[model samples]
Target: MIHWRVSLSWILVWSCSLLVGIAILCFGYFDNMLSHFQQLEPSKIEHVTQAAAKQETLPRLHSSKTGLALESQAQKEKVPNKATLTYKDFPSPVQGKILRGIGNCYLAAIESYMFHPGEDFLEPEGTVIRATHRGKVIFAGHDPLLGEKVVLDCSQGWIVTYGCLENIWVKTGENVEKQEMLGQVGFNPGAEGINDQPQLHYEVRHGNTIQNIETGGSNL
Candidate 1:
């Protein structure tokens, strides 16, 4: 019994010594860390804080730049081209009355003979004539039969012909938009005869097929 009691006392002493050593080690470690922090200058502290703030802001800056780049690319793609036009995107070529309708039973300008292939518009002399739709000019010159004429290939197998125009501004192979002025109304002496009235011979075609504007059969 005496031996067991002596062994217990020794064990208790060892445990107490271990706990005290651990406490001293913990206190010494904390004291060293505190001293290191206290030794730093104000400038060093400010620099460390600023560096941490910059690190936090970097991700947001990168995200904003990426977003702006994506938006710019989308805007570029959204830009329209000639192929963007639909068949019905055209407006009237001239603001005037339809002097001769489209069909076979129409008066020939130079003579009293019937059978006209296209519609005719009568306007005052020098009136502005505009493009029916966006297209590229394929012919811009005087035709012996049509007078001063401008022909445009408006895409989708469609073509527009403007006759009896003066002061032609667009040349062949030039791109034109809807309602853009191509020339001014001019006299068709053959059609007007002694009266000398200003007139525009407008025609729309789809793959060699002529379309009637009033009947909506012209493929627009």
Candidate 2:
């Protein structure tokens, strides 16, 4: 029994020593980690922070440049073109009453629905047709339905068309002044059967868009 008591005493002392050694090892490891963190230089930390800040601001810089470019383009669009005409520059092709106006319209003579793309002026055959605006005669040719047609490219982006003409005085590529005689009114027997009367079909266009003769042509 004395021998067992002695052995128990030794075991207890060994366990206590082992626990104390483990505690010392844990404390030493923590101290080393703390010292490593303390060794970081202030300048190095500042550099890292500045790099992170630059990364955050890079996208904002690009957005600002894009906004500036868009604003410049908008300003350019607001300014009018020097070659373009104004409201006062436009004039009528003939002095006559309006027979058929622009847009979808019904004609009694044709007895069918049609989309009239221009204004028809009631005029007698052989009435002198004049230029509506100062322009270059881009086309003076024959149309299948409009008979003899004349197209003028005026200042800016405006174009004028004179249809159902009996004759064309000006040739293609000829430059003409406003009110210059272009042709005489005629009947488009192929398409225009309205009342069998001679009339002038006038059309104005910008780009690919057809414009109204009453408002759009006047308010060039």
Candidate 3:
């Protein structure tokens, strides 16, 4: 009986060792896979390169007077609530390099879960951001993710937005002219995985759809 008990004890110890070995193997496999996924190649980022190419030939925008005239006509004609925005209805809000272009971004071989809704202009901190069209300030305040944000209502469902601002120059309900200073660009705290780079986020909305400001207009 003593010999039998010794044999049983040895079997139990071997079982525990085998289980621990298996756990270590599983952990190592997962760790390696995670690391591989985290180190995405820069060449895999197609959108960034494509946008960089497009920026070199971005079209010149019409003067501020054209934007004002378009706004006036839209208001006079009583355009529908879901007015379709033309390229001439807006202008570039900033003059800077496109940091992160509109759409998805790739990092560490991982694709972003959400599509970027606007263009990011890499400008210096405190660089002025202007309104792209004649409109009324609808929102001008701090946002949890965007920091300082400003939204302009251009009437007839057309709207323009500026984000990542350091200072806002206009107030809600105030009318702003095209090319008018709205605010200054600010540094992002990497809340959305972006580093502390100074940039202005610009978006043009016609009702619900967000327009591509690069192809849609200059500077964006």
lDDT score at residue 75, model 2, on the 0-100 scale: 100
lDDT of each: 0.80, 0.82, 0.77
Query: Candidate 2 versus the native: TM-score?
Result: 0.56
Residue 139 error, candidate 1, Å = 0.2
TM-score of 1: 0.56
Native-to-model Cα distance after best TM-score fit, residue 103 in candidate 3, in Å: 1.7
Top of the candidates by lDDT: 2
Ranking by TM-score: 2, 1, 3
Tens digit per residue, CA lDDT, model 3, 1-220: 9999999999999999999999999999999998986686766657667887777645433446678899999898886665565756775676788877767555322334556677788888988777777889999998766779999999877888888997788899899998888888888674432666788887777777777766773332
Report the number of clashing residue pairs per model. 1, 2, 2
What C-alpha root-mean-square deviation, in Å, does candidate 3 show against the real structure? Answer: 33.0
Q: Give lDDT: candidate 3, residue 210.
A: 75
Off by over 4 Å in 2: 1-83, 106-112, 216-220
Worst 10 residues of 3 by lDDT: 105-114
> Residue 64 in model 3: shift from native, Å?
44
Candidate 3 ranges beyond 4 A from true positions = 1-85, 106-112, 217-220
